[model samples]
Target: MADQVLMELGDRLRVARKVEGSSGAVLASRAGVTQPTVSRVENGQRVSSVEAVERLIAALPLPPEEAERLTSMAREAYALASEGKRVDSGVSLVPDAARKLFTAASRVRGFQSATIPAPLRSSEYAAAAGADSDSGADWAKNLDDAGKSFEFVVTESALRTWPGSGESMPAQLEHLLTLAQRPNVSLTVIPWGVGLPVMPPHGFTVCDESGVLVETFTATMTLTGSEHVAAYRDAFEALAAVAVTGDEFRRVVEDVAADLTRFIQ
Candidate 1:
C-alpha cells in the first residue's frame, strides 16, 4: 500500500514538473534540493524527510488545491514507510498506519493538547476540520468492541477550540459526553488553571505497548523504538494524573458547549 501510494505521488510530481517544462535538475535547484533527491522522489523512493517532499511540491507551479493534495499524499507515504516491517520504524509519516495501529491494538492511549482525539470526534466535526471522517467512523465501530479499551486525556483548550462552525461545536462536545459513557472508554479533560509537572509539545497515541504515533504540524511519526514509546507512555501517565474524569469531565464539556451556544446566539 505504501509503495503504491508513493509511486502514484511520484507520478503526479513527475507530471507536474513536465507540465511546467522543468527538468529534474531545474526543479531540484528551485526546491533547494539535490537532483538525486528529486530523482529519488520522482522514482517513488524514500527521501530524507517530509520537509524535503514538501519543498519539492512547493517548487512546482501546481494550484493550491493540487499542492495540498500532493503534500498530504507524501506525508501518508512517508508514514507508511516508517511503519513497514523494518527494524527502524522511528519517525515515519502515515495517518493510515496510525489508523491501522488503532484498529489492531487492544488498548489505545491518547493525549491531545490542541484537538479532540480522532476516535472521539463527531462526523460533523471531523468533516469541518478536514479530518478523515472515515477514521472517525472506523473508531466509532471499534468503540463497540468490548474487548478493546480506549483512554484519552484532552486539555480544556482542545475542547474549547472550535474547529467547525459555531453550532457544530455543541454537537461535537455532546458527542464526547455520549462517548464518555461507554464502559470501555475513559475520557478525561485537563481543565485550565491546573498546574502540570510536564508540558507535552504535541499530541500522541500509543497503540498497546508496541508503537507510538506522534502528531506534528507537517507530519505524523510512527515511533516503534522501545525507549521512544516508553517516553511517550510516561508523558501520557503524567498528563492523565492531572486530568479530570467522570462528572468533572462532563462538567467541562457541558460548560464549553454552553458557552459556544451563547456565543453563537
Candidate 2:
C-alpha cells in the first residue's frame, strides 16, 4: 500500500509535468536536481524533502497555496511510506481531508483520460472496476446528487479504451451515454485528432463551489481562492470548447460501444 501511495504520487507528478508541457529533464534543471533524481521522485522511488518538493512545486503552474499543500502531502506521503502504509488507504490526514472536500463541494467537474466518471458509473461498471473498498455507497449517492450540480469532460480515448475498473468497454461506454443525457449533467468529448495543447493525462479537478480540489494517487490537493478556482474553470471550458457535445457526443459513444461489442463477439 505504501508503494501504491508512492506510485500514485509519482503518477501525479509525471502527469502534472506533462500537463505543464515539461519534461523530467526540464523539471530537474529548473528544480536544481539531477535528471535521475527527478525521475525517481516522479516514480515514487525516493522520498522528497519538503524543501525539494517545494522547489518542484514552484516549477509547476500551481499557485503558492497549492504548492504548499502539495509539499505537505509529499511530506506526509513520505512519512507514511516509511511506516509501510499507503498514504490514502488508512484513516489518515490525506483521505479524511479528501473526503471532506468531496462532501463539501457544491459542484464538481470530473475528467477522465480513459474511463467513465465514477459518479455516473453504473453498478456493473463499478463492480467490474473493483472500486468497492476505496469509496462507499453513501459516497456514490452523494456523487449522484452532486452529479446534478457537476459537469464532466472526457477524452475520446476514455470512450474507446475502457482502461479503468469496469466489466467491459461497452458497459462503460453505455454508462457514459446514459449519463450524458441527464438533465443537469454536461458531458463533452475531446476527440482524438485535436492534439493536446498542454499534456494528456487521467485525472479530475473539483470546484468546491468556491475552491478546487485536485486529486492524484498520492495527494488530494486543495486549491482555495477565486483566482485558483478560476484557472481550472477556464481550462475546463477551453477543453470543452474543442469537444463534441449533444447528439455528436452520443453518436461517438454509440460507435465505441458497438466496436467493443464486436470485439467481444
Candidate 3:
C-alpha cells in the first residue's frame, strides 16, 4: 500500500515548490539538504525530518499559511513513522481512494471503549447499538476477507454490557474467541481487576496508515490530518501497553463467556 501520509507530504511539497516557482536545487540549498533529498521528498520516496521540514517550508517562500500547512502534514507523517505505524492518509467512509486503502491496507490499529471492534459487531449487537449506519452490507464481509489485520484493545466491562445482547451474547463471546485466534487479528483485554494509572483517553480508530476515526455521543469525527492521526496513534499505543494479550488475555475473554454461560443457566 502507498504511504498516504508521505505521499501527501510529497505532493504538498511539490505543489508549494511549483507555486513559489523555485527549482529543487534552490529549495535544497535554502533548506540545507541536498538536491537529491529534495527530489526524493518531492517524489514521496524519502521523508524529511521535522527539522528539515521546517527548513523546507521556509525555503519554499510560500505564504505563511500554506507553509505551515505543509510543515504540519510532513510532521504528521514523521510522527506516525517514528511510532512504528504506517498510514495511507486516504481512508474515507465512501468508496474513494481512502476507502480503497481501508480495504486493501495490511494493518489497522484501534482502541475501543466497548468490547469488540465495530467490524466484529454481531448482527444483534450492531442493531441494538444502532451502529449499522454508514457501515453497510460490506462491513462484515470486508472484515472477514482477511487481507487486512487488526490490533484491538478493549475494556472487560465492554463485554459485560451489550444492551440488546441476550441469546446473542453467547454467540458473541464465541465469535470473539474465534476471531482472537485468527492470525490476522490480535485482541487484548484490559481486565476489570486493574485500575488505570491515569485518566483514560477517548476511544479512536487508526485506519490503516493515516486516517483516524473517532466518535462521540453526538456525532463522529474523522481526522486525516497528520497531527490528529499521530495523537490517536499515541493514545492506542498507550492503552495497549496496559492491556493483557496472549493466553492470559484469551483466558479472560473465556472466563467472561463462562460466567455468561452460568448466568444463562
Which candidate ranks first by lDDT, i.e. highest? 1
* Candidate 3, residue 94: how far the Cα is off, in Å: 8.5
Candidate 1 lDDT, 222-242, residue by residue in tens: 887654666677668778988
Clashes of each: 3, 2, 8
The per-model lDDT (C-alpha) reads: 0.81, 0.64, 0.69
Better of 1 and 3 by TM-score: 1
Q: What are the per-residue Cα lDDT tens digits for candidate 2 across 40-64?
A: 6676664335466557777888767
Best-to-worst order by lDDT is 1, 3, 2
Instruction: Kindly list the per-residue Cα lDDT of model 3 for residues 7-42, writing each as its tens digit.
Output: 787888899888889897788878887555676677
Over all chains combined, what TM-score does candidate 2 have? 0.56
**How much is 68 displaced in model 2, in angstroms?**
30
Clashing residue pairs found in predicted model 3? 4-88, 86-209, 87-209, 87-210, 88-209, 88-210, 90-98, 91-98
TM for candidate 1 is 0.64
Output the worst ten-in-a-row residue range by lDDT, candidate 3.
Answer: 90-99
> How do the predictions measure up, each by TM-score?
0.64, 0.56, 0.58
The TM-score leader among the candidates is 1
What candidate 3 gets wrong by more than 4 Å, as runs, is 1-101, 197-201, 262-265
Q: Candidate 2: misplaced stretches above 4 Å? A: 1-93, 132-139, 143-148, 163-166, 218-221, 225-228
